[model samples]
Target: MQRILEALGWRQGSFVKPETVAKLIGDIDSTFTISANNLLVVASQSCDVASSQEEYIELSIVRPLSAEAFNKQYSHNRHPRILHIEANSNSSDEKVILELKAHEKIQIKKSLLEEFKPDSSINFLEGNLNQYIDWLAGRYKRPALPTKFDQLIASSDKKGKRKKIAKRANEYLTGIYVDIYPNRDIKDEETYSVNLLGIASNDQSIASATDALNEYADILKDAGMDVSVPKVGTEFKISVGTLRQYQRINFDYLSYEENNPIPPDTGI
Candidate 1:
């Protein structure tokens, strides 16, 4: 009999061939068709891959993603279902993005996986493999925005400065973390104070983010609560000493998201 805990060529973040992926997938109508530039990515955890206790492995459909698509298109859609594997992560010259479907995974029996090992498994570069795993786990545990807060975000595109504010915040700043006091047990029509914090990568972006946060307060003015935003600055300011005061707003709450669509991309 074959050894139960035999070694395999694949690891947690391994990238294998299309044929290998097809063998693993039992029978699901997935887009398993890999192109010349595309390859199969292993999503199973490294520990799991290493341990003999685990019986199965999971994989994700992947395709080559140009830097243009990474920056302009898919990058804007930061939803958990969407993930991009950077080109620098591997020795390969091209980048790839995961094509995750609703739990319809390219699963295979661990014993069967031992049948063959990939020629060479490509994993993410540096600490990115760990980061990818963390992201996968984080998606399930991610907190939801208050219903009222989501409503406020959805309403930002109604007109005037709100559009610019929403565009700047969502498109440029990327996130507006808020701490709304008394958010718990809020009754209908009840008012609550909001403290805003915008997150950005650089000083110039931070300045713009601060302005976006202030402009967002204008939208929140009629959103049923007192809104306070930090002023434009070269550095991020925080309340005396409480990190709890600045919770990052979920990207799902952004109006530009398909999740909270203002007008479902009318194909103009």
Candidate 2:
């Protein structure tokens, strides 16, 4: 649960502000619980509540930002042992949780919620969980860069005294390729290979790809994956003929198999 919570950006002892505001924005549920040892109250609500719900159960609410002043003012006399866990979509188990003393104020600012937007993308994936994950692991297994790179460079200041220099960079996307690998011993090294690759494209597309790729990269790394950037000059290359033949297809029941087999047909 902590791992999943960290994935949502909630660590121990951090106060959640406005309290209910976070849930309203993030689509998360709030509950109350009390500590078994000290009987400390944990409340994840708009303000605070009594121990009538449970003395030993603790509650926590995680959101984009905190509204401490708002909660304190409206809480009346029912403030519990409020602790805000300062984590959002950016947290993985690898990122250690910062310890907080009891009753410490959890800081909230506009920028923090913007930082957690990637988890919103994860939520988007959850909305189409079965379809998207299967498509990624199967039909979309071969990664490619978008064609919008040249626009970013051309629009940038190529002349003048060069206040800023525009340069090309390679964006690498690493994930569990999850396709069948060649292994004679089926029982030992079974189906699927996890491969990492670096893709080069026009500047604009790389920018968006970089953000999306890094989010997944963190998740993969946390899952004990040996992720690496694909070779740029060798493994990947762009040709005029290749671009003419390139087409991004929809991966669905008619396109890919359950196991992501080539030429379709193989189902898991």
Candidate 3:
């Protein structure tokens, strides 16, 4: 039952917010009014009788967001709203019943009363409610797992094996930081350097990072920006001396070999 509920997107610790309920119902029909905890769905076409004839569907939240509330509510009394359908100019009376329970798993039951007329168009209302249930199910469905990546990682987790799976997982889980700088000393306005940090020192990881950076640079070039292939270990110097003493520059503090430098032409 727990697995079934989780598959339907209902996490154990999460609660369905009232706003979500309102949004779901609004998606189905924007005219449906939410008064307190009850959803008022008017199933009639008559404007005059629309106010009095409304199907009241009760919605409540449990700790796990299951169908427990529906079971408890319907166990006592069933008659909540009488659905009136106009079929071929004939008015027919039908009762709206909603039942939700978890036997082996959570199940949904929504239908009209047994007294449905032969030519009644109550199926339209039933279809709408069924669609709403489908939307609700999707709303609570669980997130999909990264199956292929997980499998690849798990395959390396055998005994005496160098836990390559864990390493692979960590590679994807880690974040990369990039510092972009323009080559201020260079006469070429298109010259720029992008320093990527937090990448694994392994050759394969470095190659992959370089390939990704090249692709990004290509995208920028395609967008009318002048960017060149990044060269590793490029050096630049910054002058930190006063305007009067240009020769007394502090090359140690402003060296691009130690720190990332931004080019003066890039505006940033």
Against the true structure, whose lDDT is highest?
1
Task: Report the number of backbone clashes for model 2.
Answer: 19
lDDT per residue as tens, model 2, 1-268? 2233335453222233342333333332223322221111122221212112321213222223234323321121111122222232233433211122223222232233323312221121232323222322332243322212112212342341111111112132211122212212233233223333333344345554455444434443443334444222222354535333332211111222223433421122
Model 3 stretches with alpha carbons more than 4 Å out: 1-198, 231-268
lDDT of 3: 0.28
TM-score of each: 0.70, 0.20, 0.18
How many residue pairs clash (N, CA or C atoms closer than 3 angstroms) in each of the candidate models, in the order given?
A: 1, 19, 9
lDDT of 1 by residue, 1-268 (tens): 1243235557766776667655645543455553434566677876777676777777666665555555422332344555554524345665444433324346756666666665363556656676566546644545454555556545653565654565546555654566776755367777778877665646767766767777778777866668765543322554534445555543333333335433221100
Compared with the true structure, model 1 gives a TM-score of 0.70
Question: Per-model C-alpha lDDT, please?
Answer: 0.55, 0.28, 0.28
Model 2 off-target regions past 4 Å? 1-193, 198-201, 222-224, 230-268
Error of 2 at 94 (Å): 53
Predicted candidate 3 versus true structure: per-residue lDDT over 1-268, tens digit per residue? 3223323333211222334434444334323233334322222122322222323222322111223333321221111111111111123464333332211121111122111112222222444344333323432332221222122223443241222222332332122222334323333234334433233335445555455445544443443335545322111211223111111111011222223452111000
Residue 216 CA displacement from its true place in model 2, Å: 2.8
